[model samples]
Target: MLATMPAAPSDINVLILDDNQFDRVRIRRMFESLEFGFHLSEVENLDGLDQNLDNKDFDIVLIDYNLPQGDGLEALERIQKHERNCNATTVMIAGDDQSQIAVRALKSGCQDYIAKGTLSTHRLRSLVLSVIDAAQASPTNTDDLHERLELLVSRVKEHHSSALQPKVAMIIQDIRSLRARVYQPHSPLAVELAAVEKRCLNLWSSLSETDAITLKAPKDVRVS
Candidate 1:
């Protein structure tokens, strides 16, 4: 019997890198079919990958070992460097079931490795959970800072439309003060949270100002 796995983390975001159009589509479909709660993003080339990394944050990265410009190892190296301050987990996806390549990927900082043809939703879910657990358990100073910012954002949203104008004003002041500290080079966690703040603000701005608020209990949201 196959081993059972826990549910996927609903808050985690995933980034997929694959040059082959067919493979990219198939992998995306698999993630979608699982019905797991994951935010999926994709890139077909190194340039695209860089741009995506700069614009949005991800919880995990799934990179195909054999990309166009260089092998997966090179890409992984670049990712590690670019994401040095990030806590995202990196997993190398390979077309060939090569033990040597898997070993090398691990040595090069990949959290895990999977063969594309044998990939399954259950396995993916498990890997993602493990990565998240690890990150939370031993977060860097930067990670802690981001967590604090997230809590602040959540609290602000909870009272965002309330009649308590003073509370909302205080929250806004707190956010602005935190934003100043976030730009310091020594504050990796603050910097990461700053980026997240910008993204969230952009998304919020895109939505209409008048909208009914509904509190729905969290449910498993997955993608294939």
Candidate 2:
């Protein structure tokens, strides 16, 4: 099941490295929804990552910019030093605050940067398809994909400011509204959207919750 791809002649093998189990699960779910015969391998630490790269023949690698072991740059460096995986296509999954880091990776030979918050099922599939298509069409030319990914990086950099928190709040509200509409009463989309909405709501609740330490401080205590 992991090595067979019936949709295309050349099966795509993907390796994902992230420290968060929730993120790993989310990415796996998104990939499973693509309905393509792709093999996926995941690792949570640098050791596992190095071991996988050494043992498996992967076509692409998706690395989280911030990991417990080290950052995505360290992962990229390892990939570069690997004798067999040196030329493997790599993408960085970055937070909104990390556009500059992503840009640095892109300049250092990463294929693309995907903002963590923007990774929905549709976006994930589109990105994978674009990368795979580009890789196959002209293994040397990535101009189109590079231009588009640069645009995404620019957008992230543009939004990296004090206003980002409010913007995120607005986006979550929009998602909630959209989910409510799609999840009317009892439908499959509704069921799925309900789960999505719950996740968003939980995140919102966390954001809105007052800090426990703050609550216990003296009246004169300043949060700043």
Candidate 3:
């Protein structure tokens, strides 16, 4: 059975990178046959892919592992370098049934991988929907989990006053615990965990704003 697409507005944007014109068209046709709506931009080279990615963001990016420059994995690496493209679902297309390629791609940050030779509309739909669903559920998918969290922690230290270091440390703890329960969302524990994380974020924001106000305040000047 074909997977049902989520309740999304009009056609979702998609970017496909393949040096082969035939493969690009084949993939586009598969998407066309699906019940789900999609607006696709096809690129035949890394330069084209970079150009499209630079100008706009896509809902998903499909990468073919064979290219004149490097490969699909290389393309994925380049995409990872751009923070705006971080949320876009990325999938690797392999020419043959190579499990190794799929394993490596997944570890390196792709949402999923598929063998192009055996690609069908059903498989494509299912794979695409599954990754999209997972991404929607896991906010951690914004970027590498540890990397994103570290960036936030650094910001907290920068704008926040030194006196609140203890509270900041506690918030950091809550964030770590939040990470553990992040994927296992659903229970009351998860609900509370999310709340705790929200509070932590708000605390940081409020602290930064307070500090800014203090710095901008004028001191009372008395005539000596």
Candidate 4:
């Protein structure tokens, strides 16, 4: 039996931070053309960004890599500091050749990054829909993380002898790094990511003791 695809959101509230008027117009036009309804509010500087960020319950925030009054990364950090807005999916917009900046933004916790030169209605629609779906599916409370962790740990135990274990190990390491790199240490998302990191570490430690998968545990920490 085929699984059903989730329905598109009927309405989406979007916050955009970009000082360039032309880019704002382009983004507006692209968003307006989408079949699903979206309400976009543009912020050209830090003051506007700070004001609307607190007042609006946005589903997504599109941040530009370049800003006149302050750095875009700084703006992103400010957004993370707001606990009420933590659920919003952030996407960074960068110049076509600004790959380094884009990588930094992604590592800093933006859900995704898009090149300004490649902006189009089709691409924008796809990215917005995907982010919205992920945001909608994400856990709204801490308890959900435990349920998810248990499921992941079960998967690890089941695949203990398979080649897929190594790939899963790599994913665990990435989650650990993500948890460490998060800006809002006390935010629900950060706490959840930390829980995942701890569980994966525990799984790897147990596997190491049993000599499973030829995977060597990190040497610095003693496995419990």
lDDT of each prediction vs. the true structure? 0.69, 0.74, 0.75, 0.78
Instruction: Quickly count the clashes in candidate 4.
Output: 0
Candidate 1 vs 3: which has more TM-score: 3
Q: Rank the candidates by TM-score, best first.
A: 4, 3, 2, 1
**Candidate 2 weakest ten by summed lDDT:** 213-222
lDDT for each residue of candidate 2 in 51-90, tens digit (9 for 90 to 100): 9988988888999988886789999989988998987888
lDDT of 2: 0.74
Give one digit per residue, the lDDT tens place, for model 4 in 33-126.
Answer: 7756788999999899889988988888989988887777988898888877876778889999999988899899888888988888877777
For every model shown, the clashing-pair count is 13, 1, 0, 0
Off by over 4 Å in 4: 1-6, 139-224
Estimate TM-scores for all models.
0.56, 0.56, 0.57, 0.59
RMSD of 4: 15.6
* Candidate 2 regions with alpha-carbon error over 4 angstroms: 1-6, 138-224
Q: Which tens-of-lDDT digit does each residue in 59-85 have in candidate 1?
A: 888888887887788878777788432
The worst-scoring run of ten residues by lDDT in candidate 4 lies at 1-10
lDDT, residue 67, candidate 3: 89
On lDDT, who's better, 2 or 3?
3
Ranked by lDDT, top first: 4, 3, 2, 1
lDDT of 3 at 130: 68
